[model samples]
Target: MATSEQMEAYSQFWSLTLGFAAPFALKAAVKLDIFNIVSKFSSEQGATLDEIIQELRIKHDADSIQAERLFRLLRFLVFKKVLALNGARYGLTPMSRLLVSHGSSSDVFVGGILSFCTSEVTQRSWQHVDAAIKRPGDSNAFVEAHGMEPQDYVAAHPEFWKVIEDFRLSISTATSATITRVYDGFKSVKRLVDVGGDTGSFLAQIVRLYPHIQAVNFDLPRVIANAPAYPGVENVPGDAMDFVPPGDGIFLKSFLHMFADADAAKIVKNCHSALESDGKIIICDMVMDEGKELHLQLDMMFLSGSQRYQRTKAGWKNLLESCGFGSVRFFEADPFSITEAIKN
Candidate 1:
């Protein structure tokens, strides 16, 4: 006979092993369009299993067994707190709402990110994690699995790029909301330049908040070609590595983290050269916190997929200070952190 503590420890180990089931279940829910259907009904009233099945367009004859399976899925989601149980019906929880497409209360939707993570290409890369670790700096799991770097892979597969672009936009949308709320340093900025501003989504939000500022949405030529025109914003196609357009305020969101220290420092130096005297460079990227499981997980993903890795607070400070920046300040935010550094 085993002690209760021993049994409990064994149970926890098994639970950890089967943790992949939750995300796969959520992916299935997204594929089946379950959350969107549940959103049609009020959370108080919720949606019955029968109603969900009907919305899903399942044949009536298969309902006996299929409905039971569907119920189990919803029940598991509720257990995970991705959904709420209202009497016998199911309702969307805050997490589930982020999976929904159009009817979500918040502007940010994470369904694309979820889809990209669970996609075949990404899943295959995860399978080679052990090999990636063994090889360390020499091999990337994504390249080992896909035969190319992520950018090259995305370039070859337009569909994957679309999913990636959507994921990028979702992140920008979420980060922009937090930035506009917490930081008011943009008030003094007369000219704003957004480096790697994909589709002008991030710059558009900033322009909306501070209409007085002249904004330049700077990105690659291919990226600029796809960007829609925004009022009081210019979409400039160029390479930031070579040169960045001059601006009093330069914004680099989710950009620097994609490079190693040498390349990142070069980019920072380029921004420094482009800035007017006493100008600022604002960076929104992950600052690794050892205590946060999410940060650790993301750092691992970065390590496995590319040459990039998340920086610690000290890493960010050193990079900025070495690149001719003064008065570096950090702001806390979910998913990503903000760092404001004024050019010396």
Candidate 2:
């Protein structure tokens, strides 16, 4: 007979193996927008099946097998604390609030990250990781399978692009919320440039909130084409990896961790230079040190994106210091870790 130690080791192995189940749940939740759907389920009461069907304007019948199956899945989410259910109704938990209801506006960080990570196309990319491992390849799975970069693959494959667009739509509401949450911080700075600010959506939010703060929307020309005009805000098409707009403050919204350390340093160095010797950069990304187990699993799930997990505050501070910036301060901006760096 195997000893207790052997049994415990097997438990650990299966536990890791069952980690795939988490993403499967995430896939369903993102599709249902269950967080948002439940939030809208009459703030005073949880929803019933009929209520959910009506709210989402779906075609499924109340007693259909599909509906029953979906309800069962939702019950599981409630069990996991991802969705909160009360009697015949459903609602948000403290955690779901950071997702579905973004105080006032869309914080695409919540919407974007959740959707993209849970997507079918991205899921397929992870399957090739074992192949990547065996070959001594340059990439983990995504690049090896597609023979192209993530963005390149997306642009070239319409099927994958569909999911990306849908994913974008899922979190489209959160961009404004992100700005609303940090309006005070932006207002305090004289000149704030949003680096890699897609479509200038968040930049527009800042302009609407604080008319006095001069804003710059920084991104590639293709992305900036649809960016709306805001008074006192200049839209500049540029690569953040090579350069950043000169300003008193720089904003990076959910951008870092897309590259490995070497590339991250290149962008950090540019921001360090664009600022006054005393200027600070505002980074909106995960702070690994503050992460819970749920967040840790998420870091693992995104291994395909950059083969990088979220960085701890200490790690970030060390990174900034090495990149020619000093005097780092980490702040909790609700759902994201807002770190600041002063130019040396």
List candidate 2 segments past 4 Å from native: 1-15, 29-41, 49-58, 61-68, 88-112, 133-137, 165-184, 226-232, 260-262, 290-295, 307-311, 333-335
Q: What is every candidate's alpha-carbon RMSD to the true fold?
A: 2.3, 4.2
| Decoy 1 TM-score against native | 0.93
The backbone clash count of each candidate, in order, is 0, 11
Question: Counting only residues 3 or more apart in sequence or on different chains, how many pairs clash (N, Cα, C under 3 Å) in candidate 2?
Answer: 11
lDDT of each: 0.87, 0.71
Residue 291 error for model 1, in Å?
0.8
What residue runs in model 1 are displaced by over 4 Å at the alpha carbon?
A: 1-6, 58-65, 136-138
- Please give, for residues 1-344, the per-residue lDDT of candidate 2 as tens digits: 99999999999999888867765786667566666666665666867766776755552333443667778887777887866777777776665665664344234435555667766667777777676667664576777667777778867876776566545544434544653555456667788898987766666667777887788999998778867776777899989887888999998877886766788989999998899767888887778744487566556566654365478788788779998887788766434567887888
**Candidate 2 least-lDDT 10 residues:** 101-110
